[model samples]
Target: MSEAAIVIEHVARRFGALEAVRGATLTVERGEIFGLVGPDGAGKTTLMRMLAGVLRPDSGRITLEGIDVAADPERAKTALGYMPQRFGLYEDLTVDENAFFYGELFDVPRAEYRERVTRLLGAAGLAAFGRRLAGQLSGGMKQKLGLVCALIHTPKVLLLDEPTTGVDPVSRRDFWALLYQLREQGVTIVMSTAYMDEAQRCSRLALLHAGEVRECATPAALKRRLPGALLAIAGSDPRAIRDALADAPGVQGTLLMGDRVHVRVDDGGLRGPELEARLAERALAHAPFETVEPGIEDVFVALVGGAA
Candidate 1:
């Protein structure tokens, strides 16, 4: 295989007492959608900023597409498209104007950007809204416009920071569909998302927790890292079921999943009946316990020893 699109070696960043990212190391293959999966304050943004060359790491190194980000940020940026959590679009400007502004920032010529922006806008489903003020667009539309602006220069690597947070479920689905389209065109995308479902879409993932890279693998591989089988016991009292299974035999951990409590046991076939019997003892009427497959969040939760 060719060299990876990005390579990070022992990268670290600290802010006074808080070390935002700690000795992180990973590789992103070309044209791969590599996800930095974690919750808030997990240093996804810090690591992304370092990758964008906007923030310097306190120690270690980062390289984007063979260019050292810290040593040659300007050159690195030419091949990078960064869309931060808040897409920094000029509110007073129309969608077309905002694209023009970013194009100018990237030093793309008017003739080139005009033609390029048209294609990008059309691809992002914002062709008809070119004249609409950025401030007037809906949240989902704003995000799409932000994406359009980021792609104005047609960079090789796209860095998105939680691009779907707070977006409507339908809009989120649409946004991901667009990302998949980009992937098919051979763009190397390194994005950070707290949504485990979103993380599942990545070609491979690096699970970040408290500034540390917990694991790096495909979504299926990560789920397999979760030792033991999963048993989803649905009950009106999920909390009660979860608590009741805490000390149950062969149980590793328990988490409340809305109306269901997903309990991790050493063996599902062996403990499934045991768990049901234990719940029955407490008079908690639960749906027939299902030996379910674990998801990305379930693995993350099990890895972190609780909440995901």
Candidate 2:
């Protein structure tokens, strides 16, 4: 097998004059969960669409395994399974019926289809609800059903575009469990998500903003790359405290977190007495300050501005 399960090189996409994806490039290893992390309108969905052979890029190349997607989309299509952000499943059809319909689309044999459907339904915890109509299921169940439908044919590559956008906490947990199970079976997954926490769960991540990749690395590696030390400051008025520290000398960035203010500064410049003296001079009552490790969310915001 090739070292890369998927390769995107100098890929650019344009709708008229608007460049949705600008020179985007990345590679995914086989059997790994590679993530695209960005906010809405960051062009992740457009990039994923090109990889799935649904849309052609304006320039550059996309190859699944080793075959070029544009050169032979049908071959790429056969090996790829795509779940769009809002997947379409027949509301009137029962769970089993929906699975059967999709299995046939992938041209699975009747015998193999039956076994695959049964296993997928069980794995999604929908075995007992096979007879229930899709419309009657919960939001999470609908999402799982969409996933099972996409997996009916067991394609080598799986593409999911924001698969868990609005799901509840419990449903989100179940959905991630499903991804882990697929990973164990050696299925390579490339997904896009807006949730920072979800990005931490992947083997590696590509942080996209403003239609470009700012950084790509394991979550731990990204955290370790923070530019400076971080300190947590507490005061009687947390919001006021944050405002006071925003433009203070040595403060690089000040972000409010719950009842405390997260202060970023040059390494070794942010100290307890310094922060306390500053706050006290402003006639503010604040508790003792302490340093804390930076989190992915903070790192993401600091590295990629909200505009991106």
Candidate 3:
């Protein structure tokens, strides 16, 4: 197993009277894909910034590979690559030109830029579009170029803040592939995402809410933390079923997933059949309901007291 690459100790950051990050403590294993999962204004970006040595913590410490980030930020910067939520490329510059610009920023040798640029463009599936102006690229392509620029220096730790916010599904897939490729090259990635599916892809996750981490564990471990069993109910309007079950006798929360409504009950052994009977009484037809494992989104929703 790899060593721990990042350690956040009682880290807290505030903006005016608002606490952006409230004593958030988490550890990221080296070469592992760790995630900070939460909604907007959940302090994920603030935490990532502190870890990347770009934003200083107000009350606690952030360390990377045992080096104090606040005290030795300059030295830490060289070993960290941060892709902020809005790190955009110069619109007028070509894809290749942007890569070269970032390479120079990292002090990469001019003679090696061409080879490195080729590899990055190939990895992003933009090898044939290197000469295209960044402004001409689609949202997905722009995001890819930003990622390539961030990786130009090949830093040991990569910190990405919602790198797929506005990207299309296909581009999101490509972005994750690039992340896996980086992990294989021994890069430690600490990323934040509002998408629950993206959080499910992480090896380990920190579920954040209101600037604090509510749970930290693997996806399986987190799901197991859900208090009860899940049952999928299919009906005409799942949202209506969801609303109806929110305060139902023994139900925890009703989560809508596509055409089904996941009803979380306190006890599947006792309430499983009983809940179905009640639904039948209301003339609300549903498919065969069975006890099933809870998903990451379910666990997160339950942990955060139902989504926003």
Candidate 4:
């Protein structure tokens, strides 16, 4: 097995009356992409902040490469790079200038800083825009610049809090490509995201809800954990079919997706005839229903819908 790059043990954090994080525990293995998957207010940010050594956990411990974060935040930080939801980029400064500032802050030697900056900028496709003011760049370019600054000092682990939350789809793809390249170079990444599809891309995932980890495993394993087979019914009004099948026998859960309603049933035997009977009773017999492979979003809904 690969060595663990980060570990959290029964960590909890509170803000006044709110329990932001509760007894969360997980391990991120070296040279892998680990995703913190959850919706807003699911304690992802709180947990990430604790891991980044920015916020002290009220209880429990966090370790980066066997160094206790709370005990020596400075030492822990040296080996880690954290990009919060809102990465601080000086809009007035040019891209090269921003990289220079961060390099200086990290006390990187002048010669090494120049060489690293050139390589990083080239890799990020930002070499052409080195002299462009950050404020003048597009949202995607700005995000890329933020990433460049974070990597200026060559940290071993990278922690990102929803790095692609507001980025365009193309940019999100580009951002993920960059992450995969970093992983190839043996950097452990721990990132939190609300996007279920993005969660599917991670090598391992921790599904969190209401400040607690609901499940943690590889994406395939988590999807397999879903209790039943899923069927997709395409129709004009999914909400109607969902309501009609709410109390149907063998039906576990029904969720509306786009123009289709995903129905979870106890087994494959419940599909054709049994499902048709339920639909016919509600005059939804014409709607097309077929068995479909369950996605990570389906698993997340099945797990969190009840508690929600």
Q: Find the candidate with the highest TM-score and give its number.
A: 1
Q: Cα lDDT for residue 188, model 4?
A: 92
State candidate 1's TM-score: 0.97
Candidate lDDT values, in order: 0.90, 0.88, 0.88, 0.88
Across 6-42, the per-residue lDDT of candidate 4 in tens digits comes to 9899999999999999999898899879999888899
* Candidate 2: regions farther than 4 A off: 234-237, 268-272, 283-285, 306-308
Clashes of each: 0, 0, 0, 0
Model 4: lDDT equals 0.88
Error of 4 at 248 (Å): 2.1
Q: Write the per-residue lDDT of candidate 2 for residues 223-278, one digit (tens) a residue.
A: 99877888887776998898777777777777777788888777545455676787
Between which residue pairs do clashes occur in model 2? Answer: none
The local lDDT score (0 to 100) that residue 31 gets in candidate 4 is 89
Q: Which stretches of candidate 3 lie over 4 Å from their true place?
A: none
For model 3, the run of ten residues with the poorest summed lDDT = 237-246
Q: In model 2, which range of ten residues has the least summed lDDT?
A: 267-276
Question: Per TM-score, what order, best first?
Answer: 1, 4, 3, 2
Q: Local error of candidate 1 at 74, Å?
A: 1.1
For candidate 2, the TM-score is: 0.94
